[model samples]
Target chain A: MLSKSAARAFFLSGTLLFGAVFIWLTVDTFQRIPAQTNAGDLNESVVRGKHIWEENNCMGCHTLLGEGAYYAPELTRVYDRRGPAFIAAMLKDPEAVYPGQRRMVKYDFNEEQISDMIAFFEWIGRMDLNGFPPEPTIGMAAAAIAIPGGERPQVFTQICTACHSLGGVGGTIGPALDGVGDRFDRGYLMRWITDPQAVKPGTQMPKLELTEEQRNEVVIFLSKQREAGL
Target chain B: MKYQSQKVAYWFFATCMLLLSLQLIMAFAHSGFDVLHPWIPFNVARASHNNLLVMWLLAGFMGAAYFIIPDECERPLYWPRLAYVQLIALVVVGVTAIIGFHFGWWEGRKFLEIPRPLDYLVVVDVLLFVANIGMTIWKAPKMTTTSIVLFFGLLMAALLYLPGMIPTDHQTHDAFWRWWVVHLWVEGVWELIMGAILAYLLIRLTGVDREIVEKWLYVIVGFTFLSGILGTGHHYYFIGTPSYWLWIGGIFSALEPLAFLGMAIYGVALAKKGGRNHPNRMALFWTVGCCIMSFVGAGLLGFAHTLPQVNLFTHGTLVTAMHGHMAFWGAYAMLVLAIMTYALPLLTGRKLFDTPSASYAFWSTNIGMVCMTVAFGVAGVAQVYLERRAGMEFLDVQRELKVHFIGLILAASLFTSGIIAFIYNFIRYGLPVGEVEESVSAGAAAAAPAE
Candidate 1:
């Protein structure tokens, strides 16, 4: 038999108590956020990049820090996952990166803007987000098929894996590279890695912007992908 | 209607219907309708969709307040003209913001995408609304619990808008404060508004004793803030906030359902206890329906993911949408509709209640929304498995989820039909031109045996 006065007291006291606690926690959170999110990394470029992010309403499609529209991929860890080259290239032309898939509105950002965006994402990726974007626990075991190559090169991981699969651990857009070394020679691998369009007139793979050394590295790595043991 | 000033609420409800239609169209375009993609891109459509939902709901709340305050206070509004001016200003600001969103003239935040200049205008318009309502209550011969609770909710909602406008360069800090406006309004003060409105409706429609209804009102809203204030922690868990938030958010948010459950029980029990059948049976259906659905939608479904463990996967996925669509539809959307249905007949002197279309509107919208939630849930769960658990590529998973969006579209079409029926009923009722009748309260009249 709760009376109205008692109910009113319950509401007033509970709200004030919890509201105060929330404000105190907010203050404490602000204190810790500087270190947790690396507030010092809030450089001019990153700030400008944030402005670009908001100005373009990127969150309308993509998510950051596990907030925003779910139409696009979560981009909080994009810098770490894709690396600068891939992000820069993708920003330059989104459809070219993921052809015939979900379309991204191309902003035609200049080099400086691209770099700024990269920096912003880099800063975001480093934050301690209570272990968000959790590691894919169930699929990682199946995807970790042993590659014939001793060790995959950085160029292959950062650029080639975006479209192509290596030991079933990457994208499905391109053919699997499990026995690629057995199929193609070093010369062809080198040429194809340098420019897929040149090797095949109408290949879906764009001519990846890679340095000579990175191209060689990718070619060597692909050439080692033998069906048999390395 | 007892007061001439109550007529102003009709215009606000009309605006609501208009905005709601526009919102549905934008939502369809945003959900991969190819023909409108180039004309209304995803961002444009999304910003408009979210903004329009907020705008229309605000209008509904304002309308509900205008209609209920005069009836409760036993006096006419202090400045009825100002209510009209406020509505016009709000519509103008809303139209400008929606147009600006298309041209990339926006702040670009989700739910707060109205441009900075328009944000100021919105604040001014809301202030005018608050002042008008406040003055009405101030000059009233007597004050009721419902009027006071409703007024406080509106005032606090206006104040909460400021936190989102706080300037921030750091993304984490930005998110932390943005939730102050979004979370606090929906979960916190808005519940106060919902509670008060439900109290008013239950009092009038069910012919329940005002003492009994208002007493429970305090308890329900008491439970609301008791849990909801700390429930803001749930948003903080993964937004670069501290680890402590995980425990705080998980524990408190788990309790959030109790408040909603109370609401459901309150509505059902009062309807049974009153034992008086009002002529406006449709209004009672909506009122009771809002309560039950809010529990299932906001209370139970929200609990399904509020935990830190499950949320670790479902965060930023379509799962949130599953909960969100029904929660808003149940808690806020239906609350507004309940009040609209209750007030419409009295406002226009139309006996359109209990019509077949009215019942069809109720059933179709509820069933359609539930189906939509199921579609979102299926897509979302599949997405979590493929993308989060299995680490499939984002696009690969999205391609897989396309079929669910088709299901969503189907459900949305049914929901839209219900809305059309509701709007048709509204139009048939015509305008709020009913004469001011000197009579007993609606509850007392309903309680007496029908003549």
Candidate 2:
């Protein structure tokens, strides 16, 4: 049988050790919080949006800060993928944007409430997470739109590269143009590039304004992309 | 039922059973009915389910202490009327909090969902309980290890609840204090309570010496405090805490299984040494079964994800659900059931241990819970692979796991049946009566110090 004094000593020492470690860890947690959280996270709009999120139990469907329900997408980096306008619109009417799937229920958020939600998303985007969701570093340069140390490219980086990819480089908001020559000749390419809305009334790509020389240069560049199939 | 005042325990346990059934109903609403989405949201249902669980378990522990304390102290309860008042207040607070959850009057913290105003009521309720138990022990002729340990555990549990109430807007800071209540209660102080109850059961069931059993209790308490207090670090690994927590959490939580191993060994060894002397064999079965299953569920399964490397993949997944269901069932659920099984016949003066339903309840509940744990494990691993590992969409992964939930529902059905049987048996035994004349001699014989 164990001695009474031995058991008492063990209990006392164990309690002390446990208390010491817990205090140490708790202090460390407090020290790291201010650095990791974003400055604008505590702003009025962001704070109001946080209350709205909690009141609606959004975390029941979506994950925030790696916690809560996993039924919906992680809302951590949503501000980067779709801008504030898109987020606000989606909150107003989810089915209009995300058709064919009935996942996110439509919340009747007014304009100001929608803006607050966007503000919350924007604030969360700025936290110092040390890269929790690793971003894609490759294929991010504007080389396809305007190649460095050469003649001025026909393609405008602000217009074409913002939505489309060319020669395996650029954005993916629109279709890739790696083999556009196979799909269209120079004549069709010129008309399509000049007035995209006339070709497809509701297409997302905007028509680019170009001079005669710029138009010809863009067509010539597009014609050379057929080498992939050859 | 050595003391007439101990009958107050019956009401507390009855409330436990009532709350448990409600918790199960809410679980069904969550898993089975997709149509109830708008009216009863998932968060409302989940918060109610978890809060009810905490309420009932707290009720169970309170009941067990009331029953065990009077006998261990060799005295009647200090204030019998106070016990009844405390029980009514506890039930009132619990019902109000649960009802408030549906209307969104909740703190939104996991497990500690009761709103700020109701939290004060809970504090008052617990203080009344602690004082009642304290007075009972103080008036006793002599103090025993079993009584002192139980009192300390209950006091610590009350103290730990305060950390969850700390006001904070920072998410990381909130999570830090929340784990102090959650982790410390389960892994730290509750183990002391479980150990004391286990020792009491073993001493009574085995006809073992009090000194030997209490000695084993000391070892279990030591092991629990050594590992479990530091084991709170495991929760800090991913909650935006300092990087040093990863090392501290991983190391300490890895050692947590040792305490559970000690409890399991203590139970099994005591049973083997004592042989089958007690007529209530089902109580012994539940006592020993609780220890072994606790070791497997809380000890081994918890260790699986306690390491930082594994937790990164499995942190908030259904893997946690798997471990949670089993650990709570094996440790606290079975501990309460053991006490009930031991006390029921004595309280009502009915010897109904040899019934077929009693045997079925033991086998079916244990087997069904094990199957449910496996189902959750399979679904969780699949979810981790599809979503976290393969970078699939969250909704798509949830759709894939819908099939596994079918298995969970089936296993839960079986588990529910066993619980029904146990409750039916409890009802048939009727209300608590005064102690039988023969039990007075038997109680003395059991309490006598061994040579």
Candidate 3:
């Protein structure tokens, strides 16, 4: 029984009302975005990094803030998950980082560009995205058991764990490091960790660039990973 | 054909077929098919695939408008030569953007990946199109709701493209404004175009009274904006926007399906009510199919994840892809195909509507798309469990999902076959050399009720 004029009135009024509300919400959102997203921390490097991101069409593969193509990993929390050094190393040579995995087009960025990208991601990771990239509720319980070795080294956690599992955790790309001490001694561990391909040609692992102190720290930590007990 | 200028729509449709085939080829390459990976790369293939889709759909819409406006206005198109020029410019701009994407000359945003310079050219080309269509409607002896609604949709779509071009250093702001173009176009103004086109088809194919159909058109589009305007909040929920959008987006987007449901019912009921069936039964099938599938794909599947709770986990996964492929196919792609089915015979003066290939095109494409959605859905649900819930590494999860991509490729191949059949039929129709039939003009006069 609805007449044409009544339907037209409903359309006009509903659109006007909702349109007004949407505009008002947008205005309020802009006002609050500065604090929520830490707008002041958007330095020159971060801005340039955003340009690089757009220039390369990075969103064509990877996602940020839960938008973009689903071909690659979501990168909103990549800054927190993978530290700056690992991010830099990966950007320098993508295939070397995760060889024989899904391919990443190597952009061949210089150090400054890599650092700029890291800075941009650091800024993004600090934003209050209303708790996005949610913590895995079911998997944390299994990964929470204490390791037999002493506290893991910072360098090992940042770089080594990306490919090698320490105990029951880390990536499965390389072998688990649960009993690595039983398999290789401290000197051998140092040599292999520093230059994987030199020791064993055609290995999947790349030669990870590590500082002298960091290399010593990781080797010591791996040496303590005995199967019997620490 | 009633108007000599309507012949121009055939060229537009022809371009659509070509672009669509190119889009599918790029899709296979982007899906890690390996053969084109060395040449195309994932990003280039993705950019080409998505941009080609948008380009072809825009062409189809333009073609549909050109063909329908003249018939509805009871007059020839204004500046028909300009339509040809506009099409050429659009194709040139589209080709440049796709090639530039390969060479890393792009803006890098999703959907709005066209480079900045080409963006300006696109704006100019669209404005020419709007002006040409606007003048035709303006000079008509009598105006109808269908033509006016279609014209308004096109004009608003052109104006909305500006928001995406707004300069922003902050990623959050960039995303915020990009949705203004993407979301608003698909869920908002594009529905207006869909509604008008459906109204035009129902009136012609069903022999329904224009008053009843246009009356329901207002109600359906009324429901569209009432829900869709606020439904923009759904995109804001996770994009660093204010938290209040959680409820605003959730409540409104839940209502989005009602508009689509209304369309489906309207199409079916009108077809049954109007006993006088036009000879173009294939067009009617497509029109009705678009309505029902839009409800299932855009309405139901979209609702499956629009909620804040489910979306918290499924935010950037293949689940969104599942919803997206079907929604675009049902809503926009099928709408264009429906209009093409209706207009092609009239444009070419060939009654090839009820051929076996026509029916095959309809069934195979629908079944293939459904299979594709299922493959994506199974992969997506598994991904949500392994990656989001189980906290697995990204690559480990992807390796597990590789088999699903194989399934997707198989489904896509079937879909492509349907498209090939459709294009084969299109080519078989030859060209638009139809003369104006006096009897068809009388039917057109009857179809257009006095305002």
Residue B270 in candidate 3 has what lDDT? Answer: 88
Candidate 1 lDDT score relative to the true structure: 0.89
Q: Which sections of candidate 2 miss by over 4 Å? A: A1-4, A39-41, A70-72, A81-90, A93-108, A125-230, B434-448
Output the TM-score of candidate 1.
0.97
lDDT (10s digit) by residue, model 3, range B1-451 = 7899988899999999999999998888778544565678788888899899999999999999999999998899999999999999988998898888888888899999999999999999999999999999999997998898899999999999999999999999999999999999999999999999999999998778898999999999999999998899999888888899889999999999999999999999988887775888889999999999999999999999999988999999999999999999999999999999988888887789799999999999999999999999999999999989988788878889999999999998899999999999999888888587667657656765543
Residue range B47-90, candidate 2, lDDT tens digits: 88889999999999999999899988978899899999999999
Please name the candidate that would achieve the greatest DockQ relative to the true structure: 1
lDDT per residue (tens digit) for residues A137-205 in model 2: 333333334432234253433234434656444444467876777789998988887787788777655
lDDT, residue B234, model 3: 91
Residue pairs that clash (backbone atoms under 3 angstroms), model 2: none
lDDT tens digits by residue: candidate 1, B1-451: 8789999999999999999999998988878544566677788888899999999999999999999898888788899889999999999999998989889999878899998988999999998999988999999998989899999999999999999999999998899889999999999999999999999888887777887788899999988998998999999988888999999999999999999999999999999887667888899999999999999999999999999999999999999999999999999999999999988888887778799999999999999999999999999999999989988788878888889999999999999999999999989999877577544244433542322
Better of 1 and 2 by TM-score: 1
Order the candidates by DockQ, highest first.
1, 3, 2
TM-score of chain A of each: 0.96, 0.58, 0.95
CA lDDT of B368 in candidate 2?
Answer: 92
Q: What is the TM-score of chain B alone in each candidate?
A: 0.97, 0.98, 0.98
The alpha-carbon deviation from the true structure for residue B402 of candidate 1, after best TM-score superposition, in angstroms, is 1.4
